[model samples]
Target: MDELVRWLGVQLDADKARAAQWHDLECSIHEHQEGGLLKAVAALEVYGEVPGAVCDCGGPARVLREIDAGRQLLALHLPTPYQDEGDRWPGCTTCSWRDEMDDLQVRYPCKTVRLLALPYADRPGYREEWRP
Candidate 1:
């Protein structure tokens, strides 16, 4: 559990960093005087926003919010190093939706708590492999 939580935190940081880098690259390309101009404009385009998780709809899904599953909430409040890992269950709401008949469809994490919960290094970027 602890390992999973730590890995998740690392993943979150990596995701944010990747997003920032992408925005910076885009801004450099457009060379706008005002700040965040590219971000605002790119938000309207597909693949403009950095993907948090793989979505079924083929679009980037964000972490959105942490879903409390029992004791996980308490773990989230823990201090940096001692905090329990893999407490928050991640889900994708962006690509998930209900059908005309109201049948809801959603995507779950690709692996179980024990597997994905294991500690791992942050993935630098899509082009690069995972590193410590």
Candidate 2:
């Protein structure tokens, strides 16, 4: 459970860094062109906007929004320590979903967290068991 949490944190950090890089690239392009290309393209209204046009660039924004959503899900579904007799087990606070095998409440790093981590499956330390 601790490892999974760390892995998710690393993935989120990597995503944030990528989003920042994309945003910097967009800013550099806009600064270099001074919106001249965007203005001309908007005037034509044929392509509406270039694939990464500064006028309608949503690449970084979209990625950042997705990151925000992932963060929100992580915040909501947290690892809670529950004492069962003399032992402690990690459980999910917001995960009320039942497991198909036994119809019992899912454990920590539940399906929601697993789904959120799906995009980073290729990253190091991601286990196949984490799949939803």
Q: Which runs of model 1 end up more than 4 angstroms from their true locations? A: 24-132
Residue 14 in candidate 1, Cα distance off native in Å: 0.7
lDDT of each: 0.35, 0.69
Candidate 1 per-residue lDDT, tens place, 77-118, comes to 332332124434333223344569754443222223323333
TM-score for candidate 2, please give it: 0.66
Across 96-121, the per-residue lDDT of candidate 2 in tens digits comes to: 54467534366777888888889899
Best by lDDT: 2
Return the TM-score for each candidate structure: 0.24, 0.66
Q: What's the true lDDT of residue 93 in model 2?
A: 83
